[model samples]
Target: MPDFITLTGARENNLKNVDLRIPKGRLTVFTGVSGSGKSSLVFDTIAVESQRQLNETYPSFVRNRLPRFERPHIESLTDLSPAVVVDQRPVGGHARSTVGTMTDIQAVLRVLFSRYGTPSAGPATAYSFNDPSGMCPECDGLGRTVRPDWDRILDPARSLAGGAVRFPPFAAGTWHGQTYTNTTRLDVHKPVGAFTAEERAFLLRGRGARVRVGNTGGSRDIDYEGLADRFERLYLKRDLSALSRRTRDLVREFLTDDVCPVCRGARLNAAALATRVCGLSLADCARMQVTDLIAVLRRIDDPVAAPVARAAVDGLERIEAIGLGYLSLDRETATLSGGEGQRLKTVRHLGSSLSGLTYVFDEPSAGLHPRDVGRLGELLLRLRDRGNTVLVVEHDPDLIALADHVVDMGPGAGAGGGHVVFEGTPGALAASGTLTGRCLRRRATVKRRVRRATGGLWVKGASLHNLREVTVEFPTGVLTAVTGVAGSGKSTLTGELTAAHPDAVIVDQSAIAVSGRSTPATHLGVMDAVRRLFARSTGTSPALFSFNSAGACGGCEGRGVIVTDLAFMDPVTTVCPDCAGRRFQDEVLRLTVRGASIADVLDMGPEQALDFFGDLDVPEDAVLRPLRALRDVGLTHLALGRPLSTLSGGERQRIKLATRLHRTGAVYVLDEPTTGLHLADVGALLALLDRLVDAGNTVVVVEHHLDVVRHADWVIDLGPGGGRDGGEVIFEGTPRQMLTVQGSATAEHLRRTTV
Candidate 1:
């Protein structure tokens, strides 16, 4: 077998016809600034090509059912292996999907209980919540019941004639509302609150009465249905997804979720719940933290259950080894953070004995504490040691330091980037004249002078999630860093703080709504402004400049690409012939603002766009406001028309922060704003936070990067450890003061990073 996986003329995304040879069966860390084409090279080019080729090896029947991978824009790819990409995309499953089910540990536990439990469920399937025999009757194994929130749905202060029904569809003047308002069985002028107990029950639960609901057209006799019954029939009983987006959102506002009364959130039938081993039911085992579950599994001495127990323990230990021991098996996968979800995906592959495979990871260090990054590094090295080629697109210096080969791509970002500036060992790359190198060599010092709090926001007796009734105060008008290991209640505590202060603007790493047409211009709320600017210059309607509206290319309708479904074959996508991928009509393209068309402006980076508009004498605060905010977030190089779905996690996060910027005197709560950022970009982020503080905004950041903690005005460290061991504020002081504190994981890592 060849020792290298080679690629020549790889032009995927922003990559500049890149050529490289990555060593096989070794760890290669790809590093660069955000949007420097690191992901384009490692993920889009290498991984995509590898998976596409592997997909061809299977029969057409099998391949048709599998995920389709579009061939990347590359040439002469050679010696590729089957790839396993563990990306940062959230493990988004339904409410029934949990940690145990995701890891297959729940399946093993079921077998063990079926064989050795005191009162055994019929078979392994009988212990499975997804199985009809085992699932709870009330909640259908979902463990929770979503019911109508009567409080939100009804207005007690209003009479039937005055919009007693708070739901929009049932407002006073609507057809649905007429049934309640025009009915002679109830007093129309009486306030809902003033109604007698019988009247209230009749309003909410009465049925079988015929009522005349009329408008100017005519009166029709219809059977009167109770409000609760109507609501359940229309919204609750039916699949919420079947409703329109607006109706779904409205329905959600009037719905409340609670634990199932019959199963008490155990999600199992009585027979399954009765089955126990070591005096603990299968549900009990599923509820225990992974670390605790491992200990419990080790004590199972029954020969019949021993093998199953061992297999379960092995999987749980891998999860623990990856620094997620705090998570329970029953914990919903939907609630897992991006980092946790990525790690869980990694856990699935750790037990694989297959060799000669390419393991691809997209920033595995994201959402991890500095202390846990070392463990992640070890896992990568282990993958290499097991004779698999490990390719990682990373920014964490500690993780990069563990790489056998470092491939640094960039001299800049976007148009200015995509070249492989440095390729060598970690030590050599650090000394090289590259941005990644300079950042690695630079030393960050703790703030010498910290800002004093102008006021305080208190979270008192907060015990939500894993928090241990912890009370903490976040200082206002200062940049505060909330540092903790993953699952150490940092998010929970910050959540409570935001709950108390609802007006606080939260900028988090959660994904923005993205589609083929969703671009940086659209996301930053500047697309409309840009359209108006073009419209004013050309004396045309603003809609004429919008590809989503009047000016769309008739062939591709504004999408710029024509996707052709090939039935059993992989779907083919080609640039639209009419627009030539510009996504506008020829007439629209003919219109220009100072010699630049709308498409031309859309293609310009934020920095370039600002300059283009500035030369046109466009007001700075008009279209340029969001552009300035984008530039402030270190995304000046990002193209305005670039699809947001194509952006890296860090880039998306910065865009999110950019949208929420420029608001003064308001509390800004940011959850790991440094996620997906390059080391050099961290400096820009710190400066941005300082500006927010200087502008009289209270900035609280839940972060794990020591650099962010060091630059903070105040540090609130949570966790002696994660899960049950964490939650209390282990240290609360300036970064310098934290240097002397003991027993804090954040402080320990801080001391290590201090120059």
Candidate 2:
């Protein structure tokens, strides 16, 4: 067997014909700037190829049913193993998916209950909420039901044709929306408030009602469903969290999640609820926190339940060892943060007896508190000890310090990056004069004199989540850093603050919903100005320059690619032959401004756009302002026409921040702004925060990075520990003062980093 996995002339994405070798059965950490090809190399190249090749080994019948992956752009690979990618993406499951179900702990509990309960519930299937026999008929095992807020959905002040229905899918302009307006049942011209109770009922709750809907040629009679009935069928029946961000937002505005009155959130039938083990029902066990559950399992001294209890206790202990003791077995999997989700994924794999596999982690330290990161390091080491090759693409220096080998991949970002700068031990890589090395040792000084508060926003009693009823004051017109271990109520504190201060601009790492038509130009509101500029200069209709309109390629319409669907195989996407992926017609391409077509302008990066438009004497405020906002947020390398869907969570957060940069006197609440940033870029982020404060804005950041904590004017450190033991304000002062304090987790970590 080969000692290493070798890649010869690998050229995926930004990689410049790179050749490298990663040692097998050892832990190797890849370090680089964001977009410097670390993900391209680790995920796109290696993990994708491994999974694709593994999928091909099965029979043709099985292969056809599996997920199809396009072959990577890499030239050659050797000594590859079956790879398991444990990423930061939330453990996405339906509403029924809980911590127990996801980690297989619940499955074990179900079997134990079936066998040992005073009254047997048939089998394990009879104790499962996912099973028909055990599921509560009222709630369908979801334990909750959607109740539309009539006040939010209906505006009685307005008529049906005048946009009385506020929900997007049923709004005045939509096809379904037009159906209501064209109906003869209720007077469309009259206000909804003026209608009789029976008329209102017909419009809202009508089931078998018929209506005449307008068509292109004429009107046709169709069986019509009421708005409420249609909404329940389409949106409420599905998982709200799994929907697109836009749809979720719209649903949240009008829908209320209430506990089902019949089952009362137990999610089990009467028979399953009746079955008990040691005086505790299966429902009770599911509701208990993991730590609490361990105590319950330990007390099970029954001969039949002993072995089952032992297994449950062992699994629960492993979960607690990785610092996830705060999480309950009943907690929804969709509610877990990226950090919590990643840790849970690692916990699942730790119990596996499998060996010789490649375990790939993408920034496992992301969203983790510094104290918990030590535990994470130990977990990674355990994986390597179990006779597996562990590869981590990371930015945390602590994780990098624990590596047996290090491969530093860049000197810069975007076009300036991708080549391997150094490959050796962490100590050697540190002294090798590389970017990652210098950043590892970099120190940020605490502010000498803290800025005074112009005003204060006080939270009298914030007892959300794990947070105890604790009162704290946030000073306006200064930078405040909220530091804590994972599950220490930092998010709870910040979330409440944002809710109280509705005017505050919140920049978070939540995904930005995007369609195929959405791009940087359209998102930033710059495409219209650019189109007008082209029209005015070339003396043609502005529509002629728009690919969505007259300028679109006749063959592929506006879309640059032609998708050819292959049944039972991977679909092929080829660039349009007519316009050759330029998206515009040949006539539109011919009309150029200063030797560059509209397509060429869209392809330019934010920095390039600034320079190109500046030379053309375009107004900076009208055109360059939005472009400069992107560059200011450290997204200079992003193409103006690039799809928003392609960007990472960190990139999406920064993009949202750029839109609000022009505002003043606003409270800016940022959640982990340094999430995907390179070590070198931390200073740049500090400088930007400094600028925000100097401009008289109040900035509050929930961060784990010591560099960010060190530079803050004020620090509010939560937790002597995490979960129930945490949520108290352990330390509230400057970084320098925090260092002098004892017992606080943030202070202890900061003290070590500064030294």
Q: Tell me each candidate's RMSD, in Å, in order.
A: 3.6, 2.6
lDDT of 1 by residue, 307-356 (tens): 98999999999999999999999999988999999999999999999988
- Model 2: lDDT of residue 638: 79
19-75 per-residue lDDT for model 2 (tens digits): 999999999999987777788788878898899889888887998899887667777
TM-score of predicted structure 1? 0.92
Worst 10 residues of 1 by lDDT: 614-623
Per-model TM-score versus the true fold: 0.92, 0.94
Residue 361 error for model 2, in Å?
0.6
lDDT for model 1: 0.90
Leading candidate by lDDT:
1
Candidate 1 off by > 4 Å? 154-165, 169-249, 615-622
